[model samples]
Target: MSALFPALVAGSDRPALRLGADTLTYEELAEAAGALAVRIGGAGRVAVWATPTARTAVAVVAALLADVPAIPLNPRTGERELAHILGDSAPSVVLAGAEDVLPAGLAELPRIDVETTVTSFGPVPAAFAFAGGSDASESPALIVYTSGTTGPPKGVVLSSRAIAASLDALEEAWAWTADDVLVHALPLFHVHGLVLGVLGPLRRGGSVRHLGAFSTAGVARELGAGGGTMLFGVPTMYHRIADALADDPALVRALAEARLLVSGSAALPVHDHERITAATGRTVIERYGMTETLMNTSVPLGSHPRPGSVGLPLRGVELRLVEEDGTEMRAYDGESVGEIQVRGPNLFSAYLNRPDATAAAFDGDWFRTGDVAVREPDGYVRIVGRKATDLIKSGGYKIGAGEIENALLDHPAVREAAVTGAPDPDLGERIVAWVVPADAEKPPTAEELADHVAGLLAPHKRPRTVHFLRALPRNDMGKLLKKALPEALHG
Candidate 1:
């Protein structure tokens, strides 16, 4: 309705999006998407095979233009997850990019090709007016499914208003404007790359250059040649960049020249942070949010970074750290850990088709984020871990897996590390460290690693059980697959 990207549909001919050889001007985008909107009109929901391409953008924007809820399907999703999502959302039509080869799970749906370069009949309507009211209960813009780490992925509903509110809040937070050309090779399915990276720029009338695949070379080539100002990545991407920094002067120059380097999806190890900062004298800002909430807090621009904090809350977000017993933790003494609950326009409306799940996610006005963090007295939030996985209770001491993982990463012998809690008869839960050694033939022993951790953190927080591995299992987003590991040790 009134909230449809004004600058985008107003026929501003700026290059709105680019992916390799494909570049679409806002004028051309409106023309292509304007026509697609017509075909998609009256559809309840449209499923998009989300691949990093111009057609993916066009499909999503067109759904917005038509006032239809768009569901983005992860290109890497397994058959089970894909089936569950498709079954739950029940989209009327599934749209795939011209470049996309539809998977067997998607074959059951009525198919539509999301062509980037296509035809338009005439000038697009200035606004998209939804049938019930623009801001009615039925007006869901995007139905994004959760990663379902615990169970089946639930579709999280986000309204156009929420999206606009978040993007506007970010505009003020990061000083994001049309003048800033953004760069990233992040997957188009999630909140980081799509909601913020793609739509945020479109809202500000800026251009986005999506690196088809992430490489330090692609990042270097783009930013080095004045392609983009801001860059976004997950921790793994940044780690790769840090690993190559010594030999890659171009990457160093590009990162240094960029206005901002933002990391999310998981905590970027502090070791990587120091390495990158040491090489380029630029700090990568970390932001915190979830599938339910689009963006909550980010390390504010121009602030002296406090190495391991996600920084202050964004403009409209109201954040609070909640105790395990559901008591509100007003202020942090730095040692008190609590689950994060955020309230704001940035939050999602509900999980589609699951009223029980939706109800459980909320605590009155605020949504329970399930992430554990200790807020600094000055308001900076340092996330310890997720409540379900990373928080470990051992010998009456609560520990975060992240801090231990970071400490292990700093060791020359350790290449990759993941920490979790396993059942123990005496201690209730014992600290377990799964590690990949830098030199497989000469792997560090449990005694050495245990002492190493003891030297850095509290003696009580040291790993009780150390296991060596070839590699730590990770999701597509580079988050450690905590559940993929053994739940408990068998004697």
Candidate 2:
């Protein structure tokens, strides 16, 4: 609180947040937060579901000041999921915006109005005044949910210390400054957006240009208009931005003003990397991380990028690639494959309400990130596959889903692809590929995909069946939800 107080006071003059239609400076944002904090009189989680805006930012700031856990749910979540999250979190007060955007079931809870447009409510008393009593490096400040392999949402708790460490690491690695204005288009519900998009810039005393959501053309305009200095997005957004910038050479030049273009949440395929560089003349710095740990490794900002590699571990992070049986691989020969294990200050405290699962996730303080990757001799890490779903064992042969997915994505007709294992009698599990075509009206058939892969991939790795979908099912973070793919294909 002491650390945040000065920021609220010092940043009072600077632009703190920008939503689609509303904007707030740090001082006003803080005052609004303090008013709302008085309304939330007790300790309980607060779930926010409206669209990302300056209002939501104000609500979050208020929650933080109150020391209440703020849960940001996907604005598009259905009633069932929203109910589940709200019931689980048990928020003491439900603060919502206009009637059009509030979730249906929320009217049942005790409510408060923190809308900036209305000046009806007087400034609430500053509760629990802090005189250097609380610091930013306290307990877990945020809880973000990520869909587990089991199809249920598991809450990952992130400490303020963890968030600060990550931002510090990012600043050291990326060289972010107060002059750098970030393009904040990603959802605030996810860790990438909360840690990287919001907290990273705020702690630096820099500014962010927030979009309600991402639109390639809108982002291009923002870049063309020089709204910010850097761009951070998931691989999916980068793919769209690359396509949008293809014909508009002037827009491409405008993007050159950005110091870095970051890609995360999923592996950035080599072809996409090549396409993005060709379009913007900027290397998309691929980074490796997960919801459990804020950030593990990133491609350097100071050196030439090696396509398909998530670079060295950031400062204070210890990374080791260990075999499935838990033996550390010494050779950083860049050829050995192992599960990526991370130990760092940024690691999550634990998954919420899953003690056994939490116990299974760690090796002392080193959390096991179920990604299969190889470390190069030069210290670069290239993710080859996933341990649970990406590796398919067929006829005693091991095949990687990433290898097959990469091959499918390279095909001109394929826009997105996800490969998973399907039950087979003879083979333990046969490879199945679900693809979203570049042009929705004309999708490639099973036979066409089989023929395309027969030459590029080995017989074992070739997908046994090909399924076409309008689009791949992805989580809020743009990661392909393989568990949902099977249901999407059949139904």
Candidate 3:
């Protein structure tokens, strides 16, 4: 109900944002966004070229200030996907950095060069003041498109209420304050990078420094002794950090000095988790959420880090594990896996233009997340995998692909691993492992890998067949695309 960014509205001279060489104080950002908000205030919706730049942040902030729904367009999006998003959202204007060369799909839309507009605009309009009432809280703030694994990407309409609730919840969970300076190199397109990485800091009245591109060197420089306090990254970035720790002592020191190291977007392998902790003495906390739900759970600030667990449900969020038949599983024995259903103010309004899809996504007030997880008696949540792709039914056992993948990653010979179910006459579905070996010439044998998994877990969880690959398919966020794995393999 109140101003989303109270610091900006209150007018502070403190440094608010940094992207590469550029920096903006709170006053500067507020004025720039307020001025831009006046120009595009009446537009039904605006599309922001969500590049990892200050301009993109300013444009999105301006859109929020104007109460206009902002759609973040990924710069790397293919023409087909771009066209689909553009056609679905149907924005009146596209806001982008002055030098950005947009694709042909956005050519017809009216363009606002963010940097130029901010520089040339006059004094901030009085009408651009933050509306501090409950009525404006439910107004559409963003329409972020999901990665369409099933069909064309659906626009998830997020509200100012949802954004504020999620950010406020994170502030409580993370013990985040105005003194914390966040550092990250994640892309601006997704919730992890854009919402949590950018908006989270802004909402908390903290400063953020965006590594234009992620590098171990960049991470070291920014998070060194007297620099940023918190570091947020995905599994891929943490994996790289883990791999570099042995050779980069400066990185280890930087990480050790950081107040918090957070990983999300995808599961950070327990192997990498141990590696980083061993080197830096800093454990990376993992969180779970989706585009539809801005944030559902997080490993809280003062809690002990559980390597594979994405800790308790966030504040104001009610979470439950539901069975296949929609029965809520109340037992938390750490083995009863179920689909994660959540009810919270952090949820999106709907799937824009797809009422049927939206209706199917919810049961009563709870939104079915499709993510399968096991809950500990102590309330920690350990996500096994996705219900659709990662729940492999084999040998009359419901096995989670994540535990097996984590086990496989523990083996010295395995570099990367993904598990799925294949049709089997005897077992109904056989566990198949797709592995990228640490050594190309002398890769581990299928039998050896299977036995390794069997020794770590149950024999039923062992891969019946192992497919060796040079690499695994991953999205921009470093999440594995199990559906994209080759389907023509023969044992």
Candidate 4:
């Protein structure tokens, strides 16, 4: 029932954001957002498709305060996708970026030119005036969709309480302090960037050094110049930074200054972790999470950074490992592997308009994460494979892609790796690895990759084919899109 902006403004005036050439204090941001909220008056959903600019942040908060659902989409999505989303959400107002390319038919919709300034405005009706539903602790607030790399993305509904619980867990897990300065390079659409990168910092009265997109040199420069203490990024970003630092010793030193380095969204390979740690002297703290739950676990700060383990469950979160048949697996022991299930305050409420999927997402109160993982005796969980991609059956032997990809990444010649089961005649499926070489034209051959795996794996676990690709297709979060790799490699 509480408004986030009003709750945020109760304390003090401090710098909220530090974008290029612009710095917004909380007081200034609140005033601008409140004024804009008045201008947009009334209730109903408003889709915001803009970059991570100060104005976009203001507009999102304004929509929430105005008792309007804020649906923030990426400006780069295709016209068809945009049309589909617009038709589905049916927002009463659409606030687009000044340079955003909209679909052909948007000129007729009830839209407002967001770029235009709104100084004088009418007051928004009090919170009770809004009509659709009661603002309860469980009321759906934000709707973030999956990457849809394999299937049509489902929109996971999140409530304000859920978001707050996530922030609460992060505040303790990451040791986020008001003195922390977050260097954020991820986009705003996804949960990692929006919930963790932006909201995590804002809730703690910290500031973010926002970037338009991921840039190696630019990120290095920001790490050097800005007074940022923490950096959050995916494995791709870490790989790029490692490559950049190989050429410039100063960049390596600059990266070493961060007190905490977090990797999430996709699994961080063990080799990448060692390389990053060697170059920067900061052990990459890998966390486990999905769009459905912003963050659930993280590697403890002062503990030994295990290469493949995702540390432990965060505060206020409970975890369980379960079998395919909904039977809970024993986790206090050292040798049980099962689906990682979670039930916590931070978990998403449901999938938007997807009652069936939503119902299926939960087992009793625990949300069944499709990832297969193992919990060690020390309570650290290591993700072995994803049920959809990593669980590959070849020659009647099931394999985990994380194990294969981890093995491949350890090879001196391999810089990036993705493993998928390609169509086969006799074996039902065969393991295929698509790799990006460390040296541009000097990728390892199929025999070499197979031998590399053979030294570490059983014969059935070895990849049948090694495909040298320019780059593996990955989503914004750096998760491999195994579905797109076949078309890119073979075609």
lDDT of each: 0.85, 0.74, 0.89, 0.74
Give the total clashing residue pairs for model 1. 0
TM-score of each: 0.95, 0.89, 0.97, 0.90
What candidate 4 gets wrong by more than 4 Å, as runs, is 1-7, 11-13, 99-101, 114-136, 331-336, 394-397, 422-429, 457-459
Report the lDDT tens digits of candidate 3 across residue range 368-418: 999999999999999999999998888778888999999999999998999
Write one digit per residue (lDDT tens) for candidate 1, span 151-234: 899999998778887888888878998888899998889988888878888888898999988998999988888568999899
lDDT per residue as tens, model 4, 402-473: 878989998999888888887789998899888888887777888888988989867787899888888888
Model 3 clash count equals: 0
lDDT of 2: 0.74
The lDDT leader among the candidates is 3
- Sort by TM-score, best first: 3, 1, 4, 2
lDDT (Cα, tens digit) per residue for candidate 2, span 57-127: 66766666676777777777778777777776667666667553576777677666557543443332344
Which candidate model has the greater TM-score, 3 or 4? 3
User: Deviation in angstroms for 473 in model 4?
Assistant: 1.1
Q: Give the number of the best model, judged by TM-score.
A: 3
